[model samples]
Target: MRLIFIIVVATSLMPISAAPAQAAPLDVKGGYYHFIGDEGGDVDVTAQAAVLRNMEALTQYRSIADGSTFPGWQKEWINNLGPGVDRNFVLELNYYGAGEPTIPRPQTVDGVVVPAPDMTIQQRPGDTWKWAYGYRQVTSGQVDPLLKRALDQLKTMPYAETVNIQLGSEFDTDHEFGTTENGIAHGWAASDARALTAVQYIIGYFRSHGLPAGVTFSIGMGGWHRASFRRMHPEWLRGDVQVLQWNAYNHGTPRTPYQVFNRTRAWAIEDLPRWRTKEVVIAEWGTTANVGNQAVWIAGAGAAIKRINTDGRGFRIGTLTYYDNDPNWGELMDRDAGLEALRSVYTARPFIG
Candidate 1:
């Protein structure tokens, strides 16, 4: 049987008059995993189903970043599988380098090399390989056109209800196409004015076009200050936007977990109050723990959930979507055991009681 778990705030923490079931589920926490590839040529239906079955939410770039075959294929996938999944489907728009090369590249349209100013592709020799193979550029402006294209494609899809247009992810990283010099020229670089402007433009575009309701911007889990972005636009610092959406991959540092948790709490409790009223979303989080140390990782995760849930300051986090069977993060699942463990945590009622 499918397991369903609910979390309720304690009686002392909430008003006596409030209904016990009124407490909200932990807000926007979820997992980031690769579900589509190569224009959906080799679709992994089974694996995709397994992930959706296990996760509360998922973030995907199939229709945005790579459009060659993904747009049609993803639409099909969502149509076939989205009905049964109870989680949210956060669709990312390519506002970073994911769109650069595709943006109206100057090419021979009619067998004659003509300078198409409308075609804005400025190809660097290594950019394509870097994007496809490395996946490292953290900030890239090439995404603007790509985002427009993705939105257009989404309008044609059959499963609009299963979609949430996420403006961008991990804008603070250096590897992002938006942070580069080219990205800066395209208007995705790190000025508070520029970032805010871009956000407003995206929001305005979505609203004007009548996009779905679940659309929103997703900042990474990296502490706001640690984000390379803060170095460029320090004035945007507000106390209300909690930045805890990225992963805390341990690189063998003994104190990494402790430090990570502390930083997350500090931002949720302190930094967020100064910004807009936004809740924290651990949009992506996982540790690269080997099989021998899985217990330690699990314990650490449990502790994190307990601490965040029980904090008296009312800075409550919404969700804790652990990384499931990703190979990049040391492949948490050797077989199906990791799924079993995840099911246990997701269904357990320890936090509610």
Candidate 2:
């Protein structure tokens, strides 16, 4: 049966604790938008602020990995935007070896460098190192104090009501350095053992501290790896943990927009059944092709969003935060068509009351 429910923007919905029933229809009119750039500092900041001024939520990636550099002007924008702006501010934290400080050292099993106890292969070059250290530290529930300090800083911010802390992204992808079997020789596992431990600790910390009503823990979606890994290990399927945030982009290969959309949507749908408890959010979704196809990507993504929301049975599809025009990934908003399509959705449904 098709479930036709309201798409309430997270900013608008009452706290999950208070709203036992399903959320009211989501007002997609003004959800979050991001500005991701490695450089081009102030110019990028101004442009981002202009766009987000009209949005209901805004999430910014200050640094790629765990590095300490935040956009100098981001604080200014947040401060000036004020609480009345109604935009939720989210800081993307790549705790699992993807970003900063890098993982301390590799894991050793039986005197040989072995994959960490509970992690998958690494997708990026240095990712293995990060996973190895993160797994060792996080799994033992040893990273609580550090995480608490970081979360505490974020919580004190004025507009930090809704926070999306993305733990290890694409835990299933073999491309990541630490998740691969060969990388495992260097110390990292394919099971996310350490990350999960860290996540539990984070949830408890937030709850105990009473940060806010909407603070949540989101696990990055393992899009491509879901089907591939399931085939390899049928017994590994456990329907306990919720795979929250997903990172999807429309690029690579010769696939048409429709084909890309189908492939992307399939990834989420297949994993929904395995996730019995938590909700899903397309935390990061966009197209990286040149400026021309931006509109096509947005349109295709919007259709996919509609489909997922309507038919997402066991999982509740939460937010679809689009990627912005930037260096690492091509600009998503350069094309007027793409911007218009996104704006239409954002304005059609206002996320906040």
RMSD in angstroms, all models?
Answer: 8.1, 8.9
Candidate 1 Cα deviation (angstroms), residue 204: 1.8
Candidate 1 segments whose C-alpha is farther than 4 A from its true place:
1-54, 62-65, 68-75, 83-148, 156-162, 175-179, 182-193, 220-244, 254-262, 274-277, 290-292, 299-303, 324-330, 350-353
Question: To one decimal, what is the Cα RMSD in angstroms of model 1 from the true structure?
Answer: 8.1
Worst 10 residues of 1 by lDDT: 129-138
For each candidate, what TM-score against the reference? 0.61, 0.62
Tens-digit per-residue lDDT, 1-353, candidate 2: 12323435543576756763323235432344544334542232335435444454444443122322222233566545556443322332233323233443333322434232233345566533332334454445444444454555666655555455554444555333434222444323434443455545555665677656655555554455554423322223233222355555665553444354345455545644455345555555666765346665565544444454445354444555665656345365455565676665555432322
Backbone collision tally, model 1: 30
RMSD of 2: 8.9
Candidate 1 Cα deviation (angstroms), residue 155: 3.6
Q: Candidate 2: where is the Cα deviation over 4 Å? A: 1-25, 29-37, 40-54, 62-76, 79-133, 173-175, 179-191, 227-243, 254-271, 274-279, 290-292, 312-316, 325-330, 333-337, 349-353
